[model samples]
Target: MAIAEALLAASPQSACTAMIDFSGRVSKNPKLDIRAPGKLSLSHLLGWQGYRMLALLLSDVLALKMAWQIAAHFNQFYSPLPPELNWGSWLRLPSLFWLFAAATLLFFAYGGLYSSATQWKNYLRAGKLVSMVYLLSLVMGYFYDPKLDPPRSLFFTAWFGSVVLVIGFRLLTTLILRQFEQSQSPIPVFLIAPGDRLATLSHLLEQQLNFKGQSASHYQVVGAALATTAHTPTTVQTILASKAKEVLVENLPDTALASALYWQLRRHGITLRLLPSSVDMLHRRGLPEIFAGLPTLRVEPRFLSSLEYGLKRSIDVFGALVGVILLSPLFVAVAIASRLSSPGPIFFRQERMGLHGKVFHMWKFRTMVTEAEALQAQLEACNEIKGGVMFKIRHDPRITRFGRFLRSTSIDELPQLFNVLLGQMSLVGPRPLPLRDVERFDTWHHIRHQVLPGITGLWQVSGRSDIADFGDAVRLDLYYIDNWSLNLDLDILVETCRIVLFGKGAY
Candidate 1:
């Protein structure tokens, strides 16, 4: 992560210095001789990201004032307070408020809230984060002056006002920037990937650009090189003629066209993107995952991913909270129905594997009759979804009529939101499987279990209910884990809603 920061920080001239002897090849590509105005430099790319961060940071500072100004105005309407009751100290940014603002900025920076790299920073997320920072400030201020006894009302007012202002500012800024981007030409990009996958990959990347706002309008892939083969002088010439300043490398072997060739281009101010086969797999980016130097991707896979992943964690916490709260009435109704409809338990707790093979008793609203486990062996002939190794049966007799409704409508999975809260699961990830299914797994299949299991995953969202092979299911799960991102999670969640409302649901 630190190395990645350094690469982004590297000066344009120094970082773009081509140590490798690319001069011979450059001569062959005469277009490379002419440095066009449209051609981007390293500093230009860095400037975009750096300035975006600055804009966000400035917005946060402005929001702090908006919050204080609201609090200050509210104080005017109230009766004159005695010295101790006065909550006006929060408005004094020179002393205690200074510390609060500094701490809040630090928290934002650490959380990647200030990063322009994040395209998913919407109002709800920004508001939630702002509320937390102010709440923390309330706690710290208590310690700062134990005798002052700050009014709880003032803290709450400040917290609420800050959330509204910050989110409003951010939303306005994003809309304006998005419009500016939509009006501009896209950044020229050169793509390199396997021929078989190129068209599909290209389409997905184009879609992802829409998500990237300004960056999306900025990226325009002008040419492509074969991933399976090394780049020759002719291929290099074709790339130069396209006037591309960004290179997207996917499925390209490092030995062939990736390492030296891509690295040289990067040094010459062409940005390098070590893309996954599926562009959606970009969610797998839990770190400062881009590399100005291609070799940096090899290091820091463990810790580098965690902080960015915390962004995903925040989504999980918020989604689970909303899901559980909104569904409480439904939860009760299902509990009553399950009990009256021949269920032994309102909620089912069965041991299942999770991240790194750790076992957790996963929770689900019971959707099968009493001792359904004992009756499974008798229903072998009715198995529907699984080819083998895992068990599933469409319209199984073990499920009561009410339970069947729960399964089909996916109401049964709502209780697992509690599991998501307990940190045993994510809102979207590989599906956790039963012990019997895990016992039958092949070696390569275990990789799916590396991430926290999800309530609905690629399998559920893809509407692959007719899949007879467990291996095929595992493949989807693995794909989700590998490409997992907060945006991807939200996409699956939206699709899960569509699938459930439309009649398809995970077994």
Candidate 2:
């Protein structure tokens, strides 16, 4: 790529500079035309993210006050003290309470509670930080006065209350602020991808803007360029000219192309979202280590976070059970509509590859005619997926009028909650492939089957049926497995809900 070579030319010590020819090609020569943008000042940092952080900080302060009052109330009831020593009865809080609250705020700030980059919805993180602050305080107290008899009731109550209240208030704060964020300006974004992906990525971003509206931070694609030009002087100039605050990269080649582009954009305070392909993604999962005094990238096959995985499974079962109960009425309505729309059973059960290639019957509300399976052979030519591995069409003959509605809204997949309940699926993982699609998969594609299938996944929320290439979809699935976290799962679930609600990409 031209960008890789441009990096060396753009270096401060290099005699040969970079130049962009009229043909849109980067050439190594004297005097590069690229102008490095100035570093962002502290004033520029206070955007929407800054305002959100301030709001969260205000919530934390209020939560700490409430927790202190609650702890004091319970402590007084349990163990009354003499009037002179009863500081809880004072007009202002005891000096100890103020000191502890100040320490708690400092700990929270250090824990990234007020950072915009931290997951705002991660209530667990806030609770953990609160607990840590209290634990540290207790340890310090023990060392300070070993013989002093501290009020156990007040100390324990304050610690527990702080944790619970902080998390509760943070959740409330996030919900309230979300309503006000809609009026904010859309984030200007530049797009970078291979020629084939340029249109696809643009359409996906446009779809998100149209469907979700302003419920989320909307992005406007102010500029686009070939991924090959990513780190080139011309690309930098174009991005700067467009005044894009963020750049979304798709399938960028694995090389210095990324490093150079990152540094180039970082200097200008632009965020780079590199949604790399499978090979680069696999490289990302490796942990840097030293073997025999030589640096190496160690890729472990098994995840060491057993406790988190257990928590994930617990959430899956609980969420699935609750979903089934809550959506039973919608299920009944869809089943009735399906029966009246087509001459077929209300449910469709098809064999799908699950974890470790275990075959299971995946359930869905029937959205096609009874003869849909037999008719597949005739419709193969109409498959819209880039590779023949997966079958998809923008419009199919087998779908009944009502079936279209079901498929678009993803109501057809509601029955998969039962699969999740049976441990055949997760609420968030890779989408299981039909036996027909799996049969045509390349060797590497089977890696996705290493985890339980899900009713909704990265693939569903990223682009759904709009994604034409089976390989791109598989890359997203692999990315999910390699970087799985509770916060990531929550992010996917939230995006899935928004996409499904708007019926943006599904056929």
Best by TM-score: 2
Model 2 residue 86 CA deviation (Å) reads 13
What clash pairs does model 2 have? Answer: none
- The residue-by-residue lDDT of candidate 2 on 238-267, one tens digit each, is 888888876766666543232235535544
lDDT by residue for model 1 (187-224), tens = 67666666555565455545553423334345555776
Give the TM-score of each candidate. Answer: 0.46, 0.48
After superposition on all CA atoms, what RMSD does each candidate show versus the true structure?
A: 15.9, 18.8
Instruction: Give me the runs in candidate 2 sitting further than 4 Å from their true place.
Output: 1-132, 135-292, 296-304
Q: What's the lDDT for all of these models? A: 0.61, 0.69
Compared to the true structure, candidate 1 yields what TM-score? Answer: 0.46
Count steric clashes of candidate 2: 0
